[model samples]
Target: MKSSFTFVCCMILFSALIKSQTSLYMPLDIKKAYANGTRNYDGTPGKNYWQNSADYKISAQIFPKEKLLKGSETITYFNNSPDTLNYLVFRLYQNIYQFGAPREFGINKKDLHDGIKIHRIKLNEAEF
Candidate 1:
């Protein structure tokens, strides 16, 4: 009876460990938009306009590598919405981290604004 009880307890713990190992993933598509058969004056394919309608996905992962911290980021873009999207805006929140400092942030706010032109600005303080 004692051995049977121990076997059942071990089984329950093993099952819980397996259940906790599930993974999650998201799908995204990226595309470049340009006029068909368009050629540039310099004899190269015309540049694509990122401003046209588009979709995007951003992902990050953290893993330990040989006693060091390592991570990678991937950004996927797609064009599907009607409005032409010329640029992308990404707001990274490092302030939430305990080690984050204002000076440690590297993104250039000026360049971010230059990349995308906003047609309208709306604020909903209630949402905040």
Candidate 2:
């Protein structure tokens, strides 16, 4: 009788532990990475894994009274992927200050100004 009660208690505890555990939900990209051997199940980079990187050298000057900022950045990008690269994309956040740029809230007239003007872009010594 006492042994039977202990066994029942153990069984209930084991069942509760099983129900408490949950499986991790992996997204499609993560599953693909695993299948491609670029990521291991132990959360480590696999032998096939490689990452690209960039190095940037930037200098900037700001005028507080005029609310003006001027900057220049030279970025060197390393392509570690197997695919060939054709172009690179850039995002200019300051463009939001342009006269007619879309905005979620109203902006003061004085706060609006001509968006960032790119004087020139030079890639590998070739101006664009």
Candidate 3:
């Protein structure tokens, strides 16, 4: 009985694997990564795979009674790729509430305000 049950389970799993492989799709960029030896055909990281990393030091203060919050962050990013980077893109999710900003969900009138205020930004000890 145990052997029969195990065989049935294995058959089901094998069928599922075959079905999934038939529907597998690889985007152009992912295909490029495979060609570049950054990823293997078996969906594993290849020996040449590399990923960028960053370390952040952040400080914040909250004024509970005034319902205000302030924060600052210092990020040290390391570029592990062979190519030199000209610029970096950062996402500010809260900016979705900013005036004239596009949003998928509706926002209450009273809840809407200036999304984020950037006090200062310095890179490599030089202000931009």
Candidate 4:
């Protein structure tokens, strides 16, 4: 009974994987770039290369005894290219202590605590 159930589960999972591959979405810009010959076959940058960058100012305090961390940050963003960015991403390193976050190497133990408490974010001295 156990072996039969496992075999059925595997068959269902395989079918799902095959169906998902065909349903994946490719954005319009990528398709247009390929049609216009701006996108190379090997996926390297073409003749017109562009990138975006930002500058960050951060102030933080940590309390080891209370196991607390507090911080504030400001970002100055530069978008030289015509590409529109709907969102920005930031990473908090203190949250790495969590139980199940992926790690490249092995770890001996994990701790549970209030993950990276960010108090405030401001842009041009206006609270965000």
| Shift in Å, residue 40, candidate 2 | 1.9
**Cα-based lDDT at residue 106, candidate 1:** 63
* Model 1 steric clash total: 9
Write down the lDDT of every candidate, Cα atoms only.
Answer: 0.45, 0.92, 0.87, 0.74
Error of 4 at 86 (Å): 1.4
TM-score of each: 0.24, 0.70, 0.63, 0.44
Give the higher-TM-score candidate: 2 or 3.
2
Candidate 4 residue 105 Cα shift, in angstroms, is 12
Compared with the true structure, what per-residue lDDT tens digits does model 1 show for residues 4-61?
A: 9999999999999988857544222211212333444344655432233333343535
Best candidate (score: lDDT): 2
lDDT of 3 by residue, 16-67 (tens): 9887856568799999988889899889998889999999999999997776
Q: After superposition, how far is residue 17 of candidate 2 from its true place, in Å?
A: 15
Worst 10 residues of 1 by lDDT: 26-35
lDDT, candidate 4, 1-128, per-residue tens: 99999999999999999877665577999877777666765797765656778888889899989877677666789987778877667776856766676767665563655466556666557777
Clashing pairs in 1: 30-77, 51-84, 51-85, 51-86, 52-84, 52-85, 53-84, 53-85, 55-78
Clashes of 2: 0
Per-prediction count of colliding residue pairs? 9, 0, 0, 0
- lDDT per residue for candidate 2 within 13-125, as digits (tens), equals 99999998598788999999999999999999988999999999999999998888899988999999988889999887877879999989888888798898999999889
